[model samples]
Target: MLQQSARDFLNRQAPVKHLRSLRDAGGSKGFSREVWAEMSALGWPAMAIPEEYDGLGFGFTGMGIVLQETGRTLTPCPLLSSAMMAAAAIVHAGDDAQKSTLLPGIASGEALVTLAFDEHTHHRPGQVAATAKRTAGGFCISGHKRFVLDGAMSDQLIVSARTDDRVPDGRGISLFIVPATASGITITPCQVLDTHVLADITLDDVRLPAAALLGAENEGLAILEYALDAGRIGQSAELLGVALEAFERSIAYLKERKQFGVPIGSFQALQHRAAVLFGELELCKSLVLNALHRLDSDANEIAATASMTKAKVVETASKATAEAIQWHGGIGMTDDFDIGFFYKRARILETMLGDRYFHLDRFARQHGY
Candidate 1:
């Protein structure tokens, strides 16, 4: 299913020319509405949601398969935001009312959503700069959230903020759902290494009613924990896409590009590196699939497995992309080619949820090491 989707997309939207066109607009950061339409038409948004809610109702494994193809093409759509981050949050933490209202729209692609939880403080939702102070009607939000994925384009924004400062940090956080066009909200686009659009969102006395609060007030971090596991899995899934692509490119170059009458691929040292990269990719893939299966089955080891998968996928994929570029020589550096794009995208995807080091520590702690 994954390869077929990728093959179809390759023939249609992900050809070298199509990717180049997105690159020409700007490298790395792009959100193409037309391309988004193609993805929507393909029913990707519905894959992980329940069929009763008008979704495909498949598990993360199915979504991973589709997203592998998405990563292969590197289409500038909001897979993490629309399909995983925001969607999974709804699925895992939302109430029946919230599900009935939000899930259908999300699955159908009429609404685009993204989560904004980062406040520049390291690893604590309790470190929220944004605060929701109680008002007569409901709650008012104030402060900035940086590096929100696809912030400018998403139809709805799910925000995490502190409701109290006296408690331990993550304990006082709360999640809220607000509209993009809501009064007192500003989404400013930030230029970063990847051409992927990121936003600095400022909510100046943005009022959200009682119903806007997701789960319970001042207990959002627990809900965030659920999102984090799913988010890490999603990120791993994305890296798996880059790893496969990088390996394929390395192989192709070795077979064709010549050195002294023989293909450079014939070089012993180069062949060894390709073998290592392929092995790393396979090992990384095993962990992610294990994590995904554990989560879908509600297994006891899901959390620890997620940390394991996150560390391996990010680390191995970084090495994979770098090797692909180095072996391809200078052509990999050019904007006209996909290797550099894959490299940059791999780097961007690597740091999203938890870096390898972060997961390494978490994995050890969870295992009582």
Candidate 2:
């Protein structure tokens, strides 16, 4: 089903050109509402939600499969930012009433929600300093968040704020559902390496009702961590797809490009490079699939596995994109070539969520090293 979905999208959207057009059109959502409605009609956004919430109940594994396909084409969809990651936040921590009210629209893709967690230059979850002080009717949020995916386009923002005196430990952190059109909100558009649009959001005395809070007060770190773990697995799957696409393109170029009246692939050095890339791709695939399975089965070492998977996928995908460019030689360096597009996207994905350094450190700490 996943592969078919990808094939269907490619057939309809014309692959990389479709994404290029989205960028050219100055898309705020990085996607069209019509396409989003089509995806919703296909029941894709609901794949991660539980069956009780009118979802397919396929869990993270299903989400991983869909993301892999999206990554292959570099589809400008919010499945990762809104559906998989932010929806996980709601599904895992939201109260029954909250779940019933919020998730149905999310599942149907009628509502687009995004996470606003990073408040600083780094991707540290524990560095949340955005204050949510008690007010008359509810609370007032005040601070800034950078690199919020789909922040400007999403209908609802799942914001993380400091709710207590705890600092750098994530204990005082809390998540809230704030309207994107709220009075004190400002969204500044920012572009990343891949030409993907991110929003820098500033909350200046943004007031919300008491019922806007999701999960328990001053105890949101655990919920955030749960959602992050699921996101890491989805990211790994997407990176795996990226690596595979780049590697396949490189192999094709090698077979087609000729030197000395022979295909470049006939050369021993080029053949060796292809073999190494193939091995790494296989290893990445194994790790990604294993992590997805571990999460699906509720494994005890989920944190460690997730970190390991994320770090490996970043390394492998980076290497694959670099090799693809190198093998393509001069043509790959030009803007006309699609390989450059993949390379830029790989570079952006490298530091998204967390970089190699961050995940490696997290892996070490998870193992008590």
Candidate 3:
């Protein structure tokens, strides 16, 4: 199966043990060139690209399968930002020149990129803080983008800014693929609770050529929605992997672990809890697979399925991870234990696309009353 191949590929390249090293180096904790190169060489950074572009061209399901393995190992790479999000945008809306310039760089793993969607201090993609003024050169962008994932590390940035402030919300926002090396751009690292440091970017009259504008001017929020929908599903796949891994770990512990001269797996209470976690994992798995399948066919329903998958996967991962820790006892909490790593990875993935509560509300909204 595709999942098996993906898992085998990761194991052969960077096993679960390497994940601990990455955690020590870049598993939501640090950044390392060693780990990044290893991942890039494995074709993970271009898993979703078309074969004509030198990518695997396996579609969302294949990409999702690879992401699940990445989540299971917690290997550090720009798989999500560069491959899933930025590449998706270029594939969908970039002109021929843009694709020739950016896609090949992405395919070869020579560049890193991330899209900045939210600029609001609150929760809204439409309310962007960044503004772009039309310049003789092209456009001059001025404003700050907060909480951009990998903003500091990206060689190129895909920014959302207002070209028409009077139009309001989604209508005015636009996307710019600005080189990080460009003058007048500043990135300050902001440490997050998850141990990773996201960048807060300041674009101070950052000038760009007209070619920098992706698609049409004053029409970015629509593309942002498309890009976000794609990213959310892949995130859900990773989330599902962690939940399943943790659930399976808990089950294994219950089977082998003994208490009062009997295997804990035989206990009624533990059995019930294990069954519940199994049901949760299976539910998330179904939803994620369903979402992946719809990505190539039904663009209209993608948002709802993506939200639903994210919600279900996040909840399953949280409950499963906690239960794995508890079931494994004190040893599980120790750094020497493997279950602890899985638990930590699961917790991190739960917050990838959005929080559990955020997705739950989104799922509800998308499905109507």
Candidate 4:
């Protein structure tokens, strides 16, 4: 029921053409505010948030369902950044007062929050160079963040910085919730290949109250990891949706397009390729489902499962999109075709949160390899 409802809603309100319209218009917002408000009314932003904080408390699996539907339509929204990553961090580490103050806004879609952790071009969460030094009033943060999802339009930013004298060490990390409009903060939009907008943020002597600390200073790595794992699983679910949609569209094209009075799908080679993709997509579905379930149930296994799911899904989605374009031959490569949109989206998702290589390495390390 949840899946159907989400699919129906996204199909009606935010189909692939919605993304094209937003892209063509050169919209700074990157997504539709009206559509996002409707999503809020449907309680999507509150899916994984706790009930006590004016949320649905549905769990990660439920949120994953909604995210998968979004992927199917190539919907441009902050559901992954604000609703999943930033919300998970606050839920896992925020104090009672903080949760009470911040969560309700997120649930209502009145506030947009995103996690800013990456300092380099790669996905090294531990190699933070951002500094947060103690001040008489509270703390002052100074650093730059790149590839911040939804950073340009975010209402709040959950930034990770070094609080102790541990350069590039994970032990001294801390997270702080800072208003995007705060003094000495600059957000610059970066144009990427996909329809989404990423931002480069500069924090120069940005001061905040002591209460802004998300968790214990120098003890926030665990909380960050927990939230990242959840995000990785959520991304995996979205990738699954992308692969499915691309594969489905390619299959339909095969059945419709013909050569010499016969459908291309009747060719043995094309059939074999489709069969392989079908099997791999099926496996990806199981892996993503298991990862989502583990996030809701088994904490100890979440890290490993998240990595495995992310790595596998990334690879499969990459192949699926590539194959989709290949199967479509000439038309798929054209910008006018919707198949190219799936490919572009899949490519961008491949690098977000951690790519295949990053997750594969993490998975091996987690298993003592």
All candidates: CA RMSD in angstroms? 2.0, 1.5, 2.3, 1.0
For model 1, the stretches where C-alpha displacement exceeds 4 angstroms are 26-29, 121-126, 299-301
- Identify the candidate with maximal TM-score: 4
For model 4, residues 183-218, the per-residue Cα lDDT tens digits are 999999986897689999999999999999999999
Q: Per-residue error at 241 for model 2, in Å?
A: 0.8
Clashes of each: 5, 0, 1, 0
| Global Cα lDDT for candidate 4 | 0.92
How many clashes does the backbone of model 1 have? 5
Minimal lDDT window, size 10, model 2: 23-32
**Which scores better on lDDT, 2 or 4?**
4
lDDT of each: 0.80, 0.85, 0.79, 0.92
The best-first sequence of candidates by TM-score reads 4, 2, 1, 3
| Model 2 stretches with alpha carbons more than 4 Å out | 166-168, 299-301
Model 3: CA > 4 A from native: 25-31, 120-123, 191-195
Lowest-sum lDDT 10-residue window in model 4: 165-174
Pick the lDDT winner: 4
Alpha carbon deviation, residue 218, candidate 3 (Å): 1.8
- Work out the TM-score per prediction: 0.94, 0.96, 0.92, 0.98
